[model samples]
Target: MSSYELALDRRAKEIEWENDTCDQYDYRIAAFCGLAAGVIDALFVGAPGQGALGRLTDKGADALVQKIAVMLWKGDKRSSAGGRPRRAPDTLERAISYLEQAFPVNYDARYAADLRDTGGALSSMAAKNHHLLSLAHSPDLIGLIFSILDQFTGGASFLYKGRVIRLIPVKDARGNKTAYMQGTTFSSKLFCGICNWLGHLASDLCGSSSTRREGKTGRGAGLPIPFYNLLLLMNFGNFDGASFAELAVKVFEEGYDLRHGAAMAVPVMVEECSIKLIWALKRRFYAGKDWSECIPSSKHADLRIMLLVGNAALCLVDAADAAIRAAVSGGSPLTFVLHLNLIAWARLITLIFKELRIRYGAGVDGAFAQYLAAAGLNDAYALRQYYERMNRLDATLEQKLTEFVRETEKEYERFINGVNQSLNPACGTPRQRQEASVAFARRHGAAPERIMETPEQLREWLGGADRQKKR
Candidate 1:
């Protein structure tokens, strides 16, 4: 079979269904199944905090998975109302019951606690249970869901009105793929919004935030309402429409279709680090000592916590970077730009780490050693030395980072120019303006000196002639 045919075959097998002539309903069900299967697999393989069975038994599981089932159930109900047959109401309940029985947990107890804690209102459950919410909506978990969707949907790229929209896979400063997961591609507006949201999360955590300029809640601002609602259900995942339109034009002009999605994963990584750093700082701050003040009577306890968390965050970044490098070994311009941008972010965090360390006395090393001991690193001395070396910021490195920042800014400007040109072809180019001026002069039957380059120039000439007439 051809590759496309093979893909379809594989998808059918994975989804455990084969409908050669499927309607929109079947497609929707397939999408839901792909997502649910991904979530289930992730749970089995160890989702956020809980083990496989624990996920089904906990309030988090009930809140996330059951709600998903409820949504599908609602969709089925609507389909039935529209004259199509619907699945039984008990379908979702049965699934939940089976999961509970499989786990052999006291469902009544879990459900009672869930009701008591949530007050029987699903509306505020997410806010009240942040740990569960974060786990359910983690970037990795969402990314896994995306992977599964790719299989069920025939490709990662989606078809809307016969056009295939895909998120352009990211590349780094060294011309390497930022993420090389299967089916990754260029960005659509929705994908861009996701990236922007991730960026917002990172920026918010680190006390630095880019101006939104365009008023938009990170939720499915421009997308259709139903899809936006789905995103909310996922709880896993931006700006103005005009800015996005410009970005789309620019990306197209640059021979790339990559959009906001390309920009998102890096920020998520950066923000993950910033979150830990912020937690440590806030803990210290509450203890009656600011970074500017003395290291409080608590000594450098907060600093140690910050280091441990920061180190863990950095380790994740390293792993992500390695994966990116592996995907983009030979390098491309896109990857090079992405690499430079990501490196600047990573370095900024490192600088923050150093600043914290300098504020605390050398005795802070004792806390760091404890972290090393807890981590079970045999070479405490070597690990400390390595961390210090990595975290240290020197004059030359700082200068280079500044240069990278400037270059990245220029590249963005260039992309924006492309967007402008693409969006308004006639008014977009200087050459087009010149041609337009010539055409206008021809239409007016202008004499040799009749035409002026601009309104200001014409005004200047008219003023000169009036003065001559007075003379």
Candidate 2:
């Protein structure tokens, strides 16, 4: 079969196998798993400062920051007090300080006045929410690009008040400009920039160097949650006279940074794993399904629906908890919104999009399959094999026919030569003998009336003559 036909056949089968139907039981199980996950979220993954999981994630993040700082540290190993080797960043504060000095940037603006003094138009920028406003501080692809760009160009980029602004390089207290991406070649400069970006991120992941050094017990201004900087563009909503962009900044200032974002992911992970595990177990134990068929993959229609239902249930519970808490706190809309698990809602949104894509893809595949069937090309592989076999057989028969024809011509020539010799025993030359033989044959009608009458008859006569001569 042609490659296109083969590909169509493969795709049709794949769609068929993946189109698993979901029943009421599957949905019920999914909802149950989601509710359980929501309970976990409510009990242990609440607002950043008031949740056990949040605190744990915060500590973990601090440890990670310290670890990265130790790896990047290249300062003096000897202690100042004693001439002995000092341990690598024994404390998180020391780690933050070391990284801050190692990879310094010119974008450390603390307030609107700092930007205004530098001729920037971001009036609302502040130290408390500057990480969220700065595009280079994000942990996503946008952040990476801007981080590299800022390092290469010696400028800071910020998205503030629904507008993008770039500020010139700021001079340090010693009046020396901070060098960024210190390298001679492009490749070396790129490497230095990447290292600088990563080191800067580690330095700010927990909190700023100043905040850590001040011995602050609060969740000091850490880096924004991954991709949270994009939320600054959502300036449309008006909750209590505050736009969504403002609210996002407010949430980040209230310790809803990367550590808190990590905490929020716990319940979503639980919901996803719970539904998939339960579905896989049920298929294997109760439904008598094979191991391959029992896999709880998202490609399966049933699993996709189950995940959607599960995530939706989780979001519902999270919204309810946030609403009740907000009501208890005197019906503050911002509080309610802040308490909502944005990660869970995001997961639900992605699940919805995936379900829609799957449905649309199924429809397209069905139409293609029908078209192929109507064209009678569904069995193209078998037809192609049959034609190949017939072609081979025809070639073999033609080769054998050519050999038989050549042999028959040679036998006829021999028979004519024998007749000529017998007709004229006393021969002068071969030409004289052949002429005499022809004259004798015409006069006596000795030759066969039609030598080319039937190929089968000629073959049979030749065979019989050969057998008689041998005997």
Which stretches of candidate 1 lie above 4 Å from their native place?
1-63, 75-78, 81-88, 91-301, 304-471
RMSD of each: 28.9, 25.0
lDDT of 1 by residue, 1-471 (tens): 999998997675434322113334333433343333223322331211123432233333224434543444455433445433344223323433322222111111111123223323233222212111221122343322333333223222221111223322223112333322222432243254344323222221111112112252221111111111112221110122323222222222221111122222233334334444444454456445445433222234443333334433433443455346435666433332222223223444664565466666666668867775676443434533543563463345557767988999997886565545534555546666555665556554778577776667779999999999999
Candidate 2 lDDT, tens digit per residue, 1-471?
Answer: 899998998687568557777899998999998999999888898887689999999889988988877765545464546422256787888888877776766565566554424554666667788788888888876676677777777677887665567776455212357634578965577678777777778888888767776457877788887877766765657887898778888888888888888999999998999888988898889887778777766767788889999999999899999999999999987788778898999889877766766667657545655775675445433423544675686578668867988999997886776575745566567556655555645655566663323456668888989999999
438 Cα displacement, candidate 1 (Å)? 22
Q: 422, model 1: CA deviation in Å? A: 29
Per-candidate count of clashing residue pairs (backbone under 3 Å): 23, 0
